[model samples]
Target: MTAVIYKSKYGSTKRYAEWLAEALGADLLVRESVRAERLRQYDTLIYGGGIYAGGIAGISLLKNCFPAAEGQRLAVFAVGAAPETPESRKALLSKNFTPAMAEAPLFMLRGAMDFGKMTLKDRMMMNLMKKMLDKKPEEEREEWEKNLMSLWGRASDWCDPANLQPILNWAEN
Candidate 1:
C-alpha cells in the first residue's frame, strides 16, 4: 500500500496530494493527523508540502516519520509560487533536506497564489518582500522578483495534472 501525506497552508499542496493519491490508489493523510507509527504500514510513502520562505511547511513531520518508513520507497514533492528552474530547485532542496532525504526522488511543482486569500502574516511578508525588491535596481532584480511584482494582487493557478506525471512515473518504477 501507498500513503500520500501532505501539509498545505493555502491548499495548493493538498490539491497535488489529492491528485497523486488518486493516481496511485494510495491512502491520503494530513501531516498533522498522521502518526509516525502509522506510516509503517505503507510500502511507499509520498510527502508533499508548500514552500514558504525557502522552507517546506510541515517538513519536520516528514523527518520525524521517516525512521518508521524504514525500507519503503519514499518520494517528496514541493509546491510553490516560484517558477521551476534548476538553480532555484537545487537551492531549495539543499536548504530544506538532509543528504539522505535529498536522495529520494523529488519533484518541484508550481502552485497557485492568491493574495486576497492569504493570511495577514503572509500578506505583510509579501508586501515587505515587494518593498525590498522595489528598492533594488532593475538590473539587480532576479527573475522571480520581477515575476512576483508582475503577479502582485492578481490571483493565478499554475497547478496542472501534467505536473504530476513525473512524480507518478517515479513512483511506478
Candidate 2:
C-alpha cells in the first residue's frame, strides 16, 4: 500500500498530493493527521511539502518517522514558486535532506504564488525580499532572483497535473 501525505500552505502542494494519490490509488492524507507509529503500515510512503525558507514545510514529521519506514520505498516532492532547474533542485536537496535520506528520490514541482493569498507575515517577508532585490543591479541578480522579481506582487499558477507524471512513474516502478 502506498500513502501520499502533504503539507500545503496555499493549496498547491495538496493539489499535487491529491493527484498523485488518485493516480497511484494511494491513500491521501494531510501531514498533521498522520501518526509516526502508523508510518510502518505503508509499503511505500510519498511525502509532499511546500518549500518555505528553502526548507520543506512540515518535513520534520517525515524525518522523525523515517526510522519506522526503514525498509519501505520513500519519495518526496517539494512544491515551490521557482521554476525547476537542475541547480535549483540540487540546492533544495542539499538544503532539505540529510545523508540518511539519500535513498529517497526527490522531485521538484513548481507551485503557485499569490500575494493576495499570503498571510501578513508572508507578505511582509516578500516585501522585504523585493526591497533587497531592488537594491541589487539587474545584472548582478542571479537567475532565481530574476525569476522571483518578475513575479513579485503578482499572481502566478505553475501547478499542472502533468508535473506529477514523474512521481507517478516512480510510484508504479
Candidate 3:
C-alpha cells in the first residue's frame, strides 16, 4: 500500500496531494501529523511539499524519517509557482537534496500563487524580490522575474489531474 504525506503553505501542494491520494487510493496525511516510526507501515511513500525560496517546505519529513522507510519505495514531488522545465527541475532537485536523496525519483508539479494568500513575511520577501528585479534592465530580467511580476496580486491555479499521471505511473510500476 502507498501513503501520501504532504506540507502546503498556500494550499497548492495540498491540492496536488489530495488528487494523488484519491487517484492512487492511498492514505493521505499532512506532514505535521506523521510520526517517523509510523512510516514503516507503508510499502510505498509519496511525499509532497511546497517550494519556497528554492527550498521544499517540510522536507524534513523525509530527511528525518528516512531511516524508518528503509525498505519502502520513496518518491518525492515538489509544487512550485515556477514554470516547469528540465533546467529548473534539475536545479531545484540539485539545490534541495544531497546526491543520495537526489537519486530518488523526483517530480515537479506546478502550483498556484496568490499574493493575498501569502503570509506577511512572504509578501515582504516577494516585494523585495520585485524591487530587486525592477532594478535590472528589461533585457536582463529572467523568465521567472517576468512571471512573478505578472502574477503579483493575482490568484491562479495550475493544478491539473493529468499532472499526477507520471507519479502515479512510477508508483504502480
Q: Estimate each model's TM-score.
A: 0.94, 0.95, 0.92
lDDT of 1 by residue, 1-173 (tens): 99999999999999999999999999999999987888899888899989999888888876765656468888889999988787888887887777657678778999999999999999999999989988999788888878888898999999997899999999998
- What is the Cα root-mean-square deviation between model 1 and the actual structure? 1.3
| Candidate 3 residue spans exceeding 4 A from truth | 67-69
Error of 1 at 21 (Å): 0.5
lDDT of 2 by residue, 1-173 (tens): 99999999999999999999999999998998888887889999999999888889988887776757557988999999987788878887888777777789999999999999999999998899999999999999988799999888789999999999999999889
Provide backbone clash counts, one per model. 0, 0, 0
Quote the lDDT for 147 in model 3.
82
* lDDT on C-alpha atoms for all candidate structures: 0.88, 0.90, 0.86
Which residue runs does candidate 2 get wrong by more than 4 Å?
Answer: none
Error of 1 at 72 (Å): 0.9
Q: Encode model 3's per-residue lDDT on 115-134: one tens digit a residue.
A: 87789999999899888988
The residue ranges of model 1 lying beyond 4 angstroms of the native Cα positions read none
Candidate 1 clashes between residue pairs 3 or more apart in a chain or in different chains: none
| Preferred candidate (TM-score higher): 2 or 3 | 2
Q: Candidate 2, after superposition: displacement of residue 164 in Å?
A: 0.6
Ranking 2 against 3 by lDDT, winner: 2
**Which candidate model has the greater TM-score, 1 or 3?**
1
